[model samples]
Target: MTIDSFTKLYERAVDLQRLMSPFITGHLVVEFLLRKLIQIYDVSLTQHADDLKHARLISLNHNISTITDAQKDALVGINKIRNKFAHRITHEPTLADLKTLFIKCKDAFSDFTDGIEQGLSEIDGAASVDQLEEWEIHELFIQIAYDLHHVYHNRGGDIEEF
Candidate 1:
């Protein structure tokens, strides 16, 4: 095949690399927050808790009675996307696969203002989450992780009566 034919493939590889870096690392940050939350919730827990993987930690995060079903879906969707990248080495996940999770995030976190009609990002481009660029989606993912991190940082954060 000609180099011209491979241009799209090269672009996709670049996109994946750029996106996956944040996706993987951000998932780790969120997982850390979840584990910390669980530990703080139950002080009797040991480092055995650290052995639990991302999904398990998410399951545990659910023990917080205030976490909504939609909120759990965002975490679950993040893990699902992480799994596709981590486990499906040969598979090329598409924007279609990601859009669903973006939708979940939008649903999961309703606190965003500027009105729902304006769509996901505050930055220019992509009027809707479905239209989010590769970079934009990762930005949203990082935001999710950062928001979780802040909750952990805020001490007896707004998540509960604690």
Candidate 2:
């Protein structure tokens, strides 16, 4: 196994982050992670895509023992946001949306929220739902990439960095 495959997925996520709406980008991040989990866990891919498409399902998979509880909760939160954007064309996440998402997984995400606030403090220090959403998506992507790399390395996968 090699990190090249994982790098490609991460690059796709970065590309999506640049060109797509937050909803699309966030959804893709979760989707990519789920697909990678399927590979890492050697889960059968012949099942209905919907059965394996959920981030929560990936998190709950017994073979995915590399991630922490907080990471699992974060994935679920991201999935919730993605689902909201997916099911409603008119849905634009507001401050209320952030609050709702955060509350759903408060114990797992409070530190993450604090970190976003700290990062924002270096800028204008004003907090907006849009800003929070953007930061959360960014952080989620980073975390997913990190966890994927960790799994790959632990499995004796080699990375060729150029």
Candidate 3:
């Protein structure tokens, strides 16, 4: 693995680790090693179109594709929730919304992380060898970075980078 690729993964892992830091502080068990998983997604999405929304569209629109469509949907859903949480000034997220957000967060977390692990193994453990398609990698990184930012921001952490 090249230093660049390893650095990418390491950075993403640290972001994810920081994102989960809040849950850890709340006495809740955040068990998944999502940092590594997010890096894999970031690396794999390099060859697609520049528009991440389009890539997410392709993943969500296709039913028979290798990646699970529902997972992609959940990721998008979580993104929406995060946006609301981050942007809405006067609106307070209801308990139901938070509950749903938590569920989608965990679900998307499982789907993406599992996909990353399976994808890494399938490619002969070459995730850190070379970058994959651009859009795929971008989508993965954005999702991970968003989650990391969302979680920590909610708990009042000052994370300067993704």
Candidate 4:
């Protein structure tokens, strides 16, 4: 890549790092919210229970059963938020909206992470999925999943399962 492209990529990475604090948090939050829904509605996603693979699949699947309508909408919003913040794709997201989105994203991330952690905790030998020490583990996988999903969907193909 040219120096300009490298610079742009670096700048975009910085912006995403900043936005990720909350975007990731939003993801975690949505997880907890979904669990709460499970508790309240007695909606058991046997397919989703205790499986990181399934959890991730649910995150990317618009038709995933464990996710509620609100959660799905939030996912769509996250797609937009990531594009705007990480790609500098728009000039219209206001500072206020950005701040709000960041905070909400953080909240969602916390909730989702908590739920995932709790679920994983039940598995013998599973490690903690916290942001402080292991952010990259979760962040990298999440980004890859999202990027691949975007590419696959754009090409009119379903996400491949392994």
Better of 1 and 3 by lDDT: 1
lDDT of each residue in 31-74, candidate 1, tens digit only: 76677776666656537568878777777677663255777888
TM-score of each: 0.66, 0.56, 0.31, 0.31
| C-alpha RMSD (angstroms) for model 2 | 10.7
Off by over 4 Å in 4: 1-17, 20-64, 89-95, 99-162
Q: Estimate, for each residue in 1-162, the C-alpha lDDT of model 2 and write its tens digit.
A: 122577764664464322126546655765665555555555464253346657646555434565566657656666776777667533556555555444444444344335434433422333654344355545445445555555546654455330
Which residues of candidate 1, in runs, are more than 4 Å off?
A: 1-18, 110-134, 153-162
How would you order the candidates by TM-score, starting with the best? 1, 2, 3, 4
lDDT of each: 0.60, 0.51, 0.38, 0.42
In model 2, what are the clashing residue pairs, if there are any? none
RMSD of 4: 14.0
Q: Model 3 over residues 92-151: C-alpha lDDT tens digits?
A: 334344345445444554434443333333334334312232232233344444554454
Candidate 2 off by > 4 Å: 1-20, 43-51, 60-63, 96-124, 130-136, 160-162
Q: What is the lDDT of residue 152 in candidate 4?
A: 39
- Once fitted onto the true fold, the runs of candidate 3 whose alpha carbons sit more than 4 angstroms away are 1-48, 54-66, 105-162
2 versus 4: better lDDT goes to: 2
| Model 2 worst lDDT run, 10 consecutive residues | 117-126
Spell out the clash pairs found in candidate 3: 42-137, 45-133, 45-134, 45-136, 45-137, 46-133, 46-134, 47-133, 47-134
TM-score of 3: 0.31
